[model samples]
Target: MQFKNRPNECVTTTDGREVWLSRSVATAVCILLECEGRPYILVNQRGPGMPDFAGYWNLPCGYLDYDETTAEAAMREVWEECGVNTLELLAQATCEFFSAPWDVNSTPRGARQNVTIHHGLFARVAQLPPVSNANNEPDETTDIRWLPLSDVETLTFAFNHHERIADFLAHVEKLAGISYR
Candidate 1:
């Protein structure tokens, strides 16, 4: 699947020189396991207005703000995107993807204009408290669901997120000494 909106781009500066600009965005994806020690994954409904992966099932995550640590951003985004305030990081992993710079002249308003090297940080939440979104904008997520890891294939997840989900599930399955296809 080709995403029209990418993080990298080239621009023509005032001097008529082509300038390449790249952006680094950090996101935290939460895999909230069932509190009863069962093997299940927590997912959230993405906010409708989000340009990428909106209205789909996704892990609780968002961009790491400037001056914020990855851990800080992870916990914060979890609470903001989902109604989970008591989240604790159980583990972490990262994934990155690259795209060529593209013109944003036809891009959506307020889009991140540049080539983006996005870092996805995976986190396991220890405490899953029922929470609400603090962000006033049409939040990127509106609902949350807990599903067995085996059912991940049934959810409509973003392209970049699928691999990380599989990797995390595999790690957990290995730790529990359970066989998963």
Candidate 2:
């Protein structure tokens, strides 16, 4: 049986006929918030003591627990990692798909199994966090900031998040009917 497009699911177009769905193993979220009349993306930096990509920045991300839905996990993670509690899902937006395999030698968890799934989701907040993300968890995140999308290209990101951000921006223009300057 072939997969059918679910309503509001994300699809991409290429060369008129070529199209595909985005997928990833775990969910990562992009929360678009604005300040001073400019759009910004919320990102968190890893703590220096972490095993992987320590000191690198990334979107609010986490693996889905056994009982939690993607959106639930996303909300929980955002609250856990960031101090903001006002974000709600832009559930109508298509989920940007991502695919990749865990390193076999480095991690026996997946045994090199590649996993694909949608993000926690593209969510939104009414405004920037007044006090901002304060990592109260165990040394997971060191800092959080709202940075202008225009300056995104200049920063260092972990896990190819830079490419992910670019993909999100493009999709916002194409599917969301909003253009980023």
Candidate 3:
């Protein structure tokens, strides 16, 4: 059966059966760093006037462009939102996928019916790099920070990022053969 007035949302298969389109794919980057022998992760505050979760903190993330791989999209989002070049930094990174469904009435702009694929790009660093937009123009992020893992529980995270952060930390703990608690 064809969906009425929603041609883009449905497609006919070779067997002539109509199927709903798959969910959109987005990428979320978890840039892990080590500072002063402690672990930190990159996060950014959504700028004011954002369609969803404005003023709340989130990982450097965006939708995957049609011409790029998920890894490339993650790296691009990192540079765009945090001004950090991840091409060299992500040599040792790992990736994970997660499914995120928006509330019926709470879908954000550009992310309706999308599923986020979380990418964890962990790196060891001695110092934090300064973050600024390459074009010196305002964008989606208002603040960028390298937050200590121990302090992550105290902040409000957007897009279910708190769970994503926890998962990353758990993975780190498993790799390091240690547990936080």
Candidate 4:
């Protein structure tokens, strides 16, 4: 089929078909110890000047690099954004595929079409790490915090990350044979 370039995001086939390319992203849901008897999860706020969702909270996530496994990328993002180096990945929580009509003027870079793989990890720490001092990508993340699960519903999240957090919580609940609802 004859190929036509579409600004590196899509290809036009000979038969007038457009095929979109997707980027694989890895997201980590890091569960930490109970604080004041409430379970908390790690999250980061997007830095100012971010291409999309600036100032919004989200799980530690990023596009997977070449030759890197999703789990490896997830762990790396956790360290870069949350400054947490110790984690035991429990499982692959979920995978989500998202796509929309590509608009060159409005679509954020690296989000034309994305396949996000979420991994659930547990961190054994008595206190939260000093993110500002240890974060490797300060430009990508402005703040890192351990958000109590009870407060998730009150915060705004980017890229539907709230759903990912919910899924992880459900998985943990299943494992513990307890239901929050």
Candidate 5:
């Protein structure tokens, strides 16, 4: 099926360029697991070929496939990327994020004027199977690991992912009624 443009979705900039306006909902699942008897969040660094922020480490994230719900997308991304299949939805953040093409005029394949809506969800699990580089999806990532939240602050993340992860962590803490930091 062809993607229809939303009403007033495409807006021409002052530079006189026509671009497509596409909006997609994505899920970023924060999965916690015990490694070496300590709690760690599953994080990943996209391979060097990704169009976005390549090789940047962040949480498990992906766009919602057609006919998939938010929760299902979350679980699927976690499982496909990190080999974690079992997860319980803990909390969904209050705010979602929109990432639109900053340079619509120059972006290739008319992907420039698109806006992406990102949903952040927290997931808990007993443990994770070993992260494998088994799937090939564009720049399929390989350097997957479990790390403390503090590590997130020090590492470089794709887009505003670190902030989003921080937001989810805070939301989880609020839901638990205690500060885990």
Candidate 6:
């Protein structure tokens, strides 16, 4: 059987023999909170103690638990990483499709053995309440902030998150009237 475009489900690879090997499925929510007529994106700095990609900037995102929707994962990640309860999802975007090489040595617990980087983007409109939690956070993520998308290019963030930043810059123009050519 072939796969249809399901925004929330991960599809198995084309080869029929790969059952246990599955694609890495994850999602991200880009909350564009407006302040002073400017668009600011919520960003997080990886925890210094994280084993990989530590001290790097990235969007508030995390893996989806079994039976959880992308939107749910996004909201949960935002709350866990930043302690803000978002009201609703405003818009959603999918990353450009690309085939990623399969790796045999890297194994993150609960990570899909067949890892392909597919990104889903979400936008939240309302302001979130200030609530911080120390116990409920991924070891790899630390420090959260909302910054202007135009100024984000100056920061040296992990390479994987650069595409989201580009998408974010586009959203800033569409939502906040900020243009970058």
Scored by lDDT, the top model is: 3
| Window of ten residues with lowest summed lDDT in model 4 | 95-104
lDDT of each: 0.52, 0.60, 0.70, 0.61, 0.59, 0.55
Model 1 over residues 101-152: C-alpha lDDT tens digits?
1111222335443222222222333544455666525766677766666787
Q: Per-residue lDDT tens digits of candidate 5, residues 1-181?
A: 9775456467787899986556555666666543454556778889876677777887787777889776667667877777755343233222222122111111223643423333443333455456765664756785888777657778898756677666655655665543336
For candidate 4, write residues 93-156 as lDDT tens digits: 2211111111112234443555556665433344555555265554787777877778888889
Off by over 4 Å in 5: 1-21, 34-37, 88-128
Model 1 is weakest, by summed lDDT over 10 consecutive residues, at 95-104
Candidate 2, residues 1-181, lDDT tens digits: the string is 8765344344556655544433334566666654566878778888866678889998877666778766666666777777656343343323322222111112223332224233433334455664244544678888888878888887789877777677666655665566674
2 or 4, greater by TM-score: 4
> What's the count of clashing pairs in each model shown?
12, 6, 0, 0, 0, 0
Off by over 4 Å in 6: 1-19, 88-135, 171-181
Q: Which run of 10 residues does model 2 get worst, by summed lDDT?
A: 99-108
Error of 4 at 156 (Å): 0.7
- TM-score winner between candidates 4 and 6: 4
Worst 10 residues of 6 by lDDT: 95-104
RMSD of each: 9.0, 13.2, 7.5, 8.9, 9.5, 9.7
| Residue-level lDDT tens digits of model 3 in 83-174 | 98776565534322212211122233553766666666555666766776562136587888888888898889988788877776676566
Candidate 6 lDDT = 0.55
lDDT of 6 at 137: 49
Count steric clashes of candidate 6. 0
